[model samples]
Target: MNIDIKADDSPVTRADREVEAHLREMIAATYPDHGIIGEEHGSTGADREYVWILDPIDGTKAFITGRPLFGTLIGLLRDGRPILGVIDHPALNERWIGGLDYPTRFCGAPARTRVCATVENAILAATAPEMFVGKPAFEGLRQRVKLPVWGGDCFNYGLVASGHLDLAVEAGMAIYDYLPLVPVITAAGGVITDWRGQALGLDSGDEVLAAGDPALHQAAVAILKG
Candidate 1:
């Protein structure tokens, strides 16, 4: 589908809208009482007991630039808490899924994050440095992690969940942008939280930090807090 600009100046494409619509339609047909929230479309029954979150294209800019790192994010929230998630990179033929009771799976096999006890040796990533424009917390992280990469979008979180990347820090994220990563990373033995080390939810703020090791996560949180 062709590309277009949203009111917020972010890129969008017909594919995003069409895929979200199709997913919403299928969810509604299968679970008529369930709620649905999507980036392309607004929410329906969001206050219900169960809600499905969808981001048909998680990295529209990457997709527009012909980068296969963009992904489709699908998350299930129970009472405003994420319980299930899926990050699918169709172009890369990679997919990761997880849930409260379901083990994280990458390309149909069980997945787990690695143990990197220190940020100095951790492989770090974020969607872009610009995402941290006014957030000093990110700078604190920037000075700590080794070999920080500039781009990955949701793909980095998938890598973290698959034991490939050690950490991912993102700022200025919407609920849909970070929700899917929660289940994926947490289920993979990683930790994801806000800069304050608080749990994330539908009403969480923009800043997010994820780490493969709990010790590394706490270290980053301490740095952000300091």
Candidate 2:
């Protein structure tokens, strides 16, 4: 699993790759026929009953920059719906795991979102502002809400799930980026969906919005819908 830390100086040391490789090997040996898809390495074994998705280093840019926002994301999907999720940020000394029977935690503490009233009071996050094609819509959203407090890669999603941030919006993301997050956020009593307010499925390809509360989610959706 040795991962070479690229010139970017990200935290992409062998630990990142090794962890995913170890998990892949374990899944393969245990399940024997399960599928695995990873960020560093590609996919293998597709026709199985369960599929494991891995993002060994989710916030590579931040990782390279020596930021502690990167995390190891692992997700298990059954029939294309995530059934289990784990987000580990060792540098931050925090980890979150959720599934059918497992309890969710943040740094070994129970985590939940804070109650937010109108968009004006909510804390919003996004991966990048320029990525949003509907600039006017986004500006409208900003005008109607509290000043966003954070914007970056997977860190935004992590913040939303941990209740540090209220909503996270992003455009131009892949399944691997969003899949592991769906169950984690939802299980934390949050709402995640496309900008259209449609349920975000495994096959979805559009902007994403995840909110700590349903009301905030709906309000964000309406702003994006405009």
Candidate 3:
């Protein structure tokens, strides 16, 4: 589980591998028929109707840099759509959990997203600006938001779900990276989707947006789509 670099130059640590393995084992033992997909390991039992997604270390770069924003993401996909999700921040002792019919919760309390109708009043977050390097969509969002903070990874989605951050835009994501955020944000009265304003599915593309308010999401999507 030692640190290693992927061909994409992203960082992966022992903690990430170990955690994913641990979660996979638990899921297999409890739900043998369910599929599993993870960042450290590849997909398994993907043909099953129910699948579990894992991103053990959503922000390895932040973790390696001694930042507490790193998070562990877990999601349960029912019929290729996310139905349950959890974002855990070990260093911060914070956790956000939600499901299709379940209310979102943060640290034992009910979680709700804030309402910011306009981009000029929104607090936006992205993992890094470099992710948007030549992407016009992201550049549009960068210019529209009132405040743009960098480097939260999955935690930024959690913050949006818990009524902290107003919006989060990310590029170059995978199923494991963003799937776990869908339920949490949606259950908190927020909206999470692809850049084209389409519903995020198992095979959705990399670009993603999470906004605390539906109007704000629509506005942001308009800017990105421009």
Candidate 4:
């Protein structure tokens, strides 16, 4: 597939376009009245009570490099809140399904977050170090953690949901990027919110933080602020 760069300088490939288009078509055909927000295509009736957010390729850079870390993200919002989400790694034959009303599942088995009480004991992951460009103090938090991992994109968040990672933090993310993660993380008994510790929503900003433990979340938020 061919690749093109967007106005924001992010690369968009034909695979991204085709996948999002096909998913949008299915959503439209199945739920004609529902809204859609996609990474490749623009939004349609996004203010509706029921909306689907799609990120056809969450780790495009990794995908282009033939890394299996990329995945497709889909989230369903009801009245502006995420009710369900799915992260599917087609290459790995792995899938995670999560919802506010049910326990998270990885390949149909229950997925639960592990407990960690503080940042000092946490294994933190971020999509990239560039995410903290303007926030120097975040580097200090990174250093304070038990281990600071440097890659994984959306896969990092999924690791947090599955109890394999203690925390995932990022900034300058869009609605489609973070929205799909909310339900998955929360369903696994984790917490996801903005750096300020507020809930995530369609109107939320670019910063995101996910933690397997609430106490770790609180401590991480303070470190993020500094």
Candidate 5:
């Protein structure tokens, strides 16, 4: 039940530290040559050919508030490209996983994104408007969408991959925050990229846009850029 604040003013709890440490141990033991990067523990061998990105708790605020909207995010980068991701909502007993060569799966079944090929028809969600501070153009993108709900954290991306949500956009994210979402959204027949419409990678900036349909993503990116 312990909680502490990180320098970025984000909350971190005992669960976050414990989970990340355990996962890091397992990964190090099983894949000694692969790199590891974690929100809590930092990185090691990050220049290796393969790296694992970890966010032990993607929605710590939601978790501390006793909401089930939190999740553990795990992503794999092969040569700096996101090739796989897993989002696990332990409290809800739901999970989503995907990879470049595999279709997305939710709760052991194949999952896919819903089709809404344009932004005007899409439902959008972000963690919060405050997260977009100084990025006024995000408001324009919000207005273009059919609906914009806030505060789902990483769960929103999993929903997009599962066909329950259409678009998820956010800024000020770290590699662990958005990397895990890349493969899940893309393998579900959706698209995920930065505001520039380029692929997400270790070097990508914080702005992220994910859509259940590729065309819809294109429209959203254009609005975000304007």
Candidate 6:
């Protein structure tokens, strides 16, 4: 399987399509009643109560470049709220999975957030600095924030959910890019939402922020809302 990157710089690869195909086939065979919405392919079986949202390769550019920042995102939504999420970074040999009954873990051990307050002391990540689109609010927020250690696609959110980063923010991401992350971060004792602090769900439009602690999240939101 081979995938072609679009003119917009969004990437595609064999792994991306293959992973989604495999997952779709498995879901169809095991849970024939459920629905699926994927990045590469579109939607199927919409009438069911359960929907599997997939971004087979969250960072296809990184994957193609061998950067190890790419990942396979799988989210199971029940009644429009994600109940199970799996982020697999095969190149990094790391996979984070969480659900109603499953514990949040890095590898096999439980993971928890560290108390990091004040933007100055916090580590941050974002997909692109230009994505803010000349919004002074976001510019002001960036200035006030602490050191931005690294940036990537959904990998940043994965780091925040795993307690390795304090926050991850992005200006214009689709539901597929944000929905799978909501449950993963929240289940790990973190907070996730749009710039206004509104709860992130399947239907949330674009913008997003994921933080490991509530106070950090509130502070970040205040900056973004400014």
lDDT, candidate 6, 167-212, per-residue tens:
8888778777888887778878888899899987767878898889
- C-alpha lDDT values of all predictions: 0.91, 0.76, 0.92, 0.92, 0.92, 0.81
Residue 85 of model 4, lDDT score:
95
Poorest 10 consecutive residues by lDDT, candidate 6: 1-10
| CA error at residue 11 for candidate 3, angstroms | 1.2
Off by over 4 Å in 3: none
Worst 10 residues of 5 by lDDT: 217-226
Error of 5 at 4 (Å): 1.1
For model 1, the local distance difference test gives 0.91
Off by over 4 Å in 5: none
Give one digit per residue, the lDDT tens place, for model 3 in 38-94.
998999988789999999989998888899999999999988989999999999999
Please give the TM-score that candidate 2 achieves against the real structure: 0.85
TM-score of 6: 0.92
- Segments of candidate 2 deviating more than 4 angstroms: 1-19, 101-103, 133-136
Better of 2 and 5 by lDDT: 5
lDDT of 5: 0.92
Q: Which ten residues in a row have the lowest lDDT in candidate 4?
A: 1-10
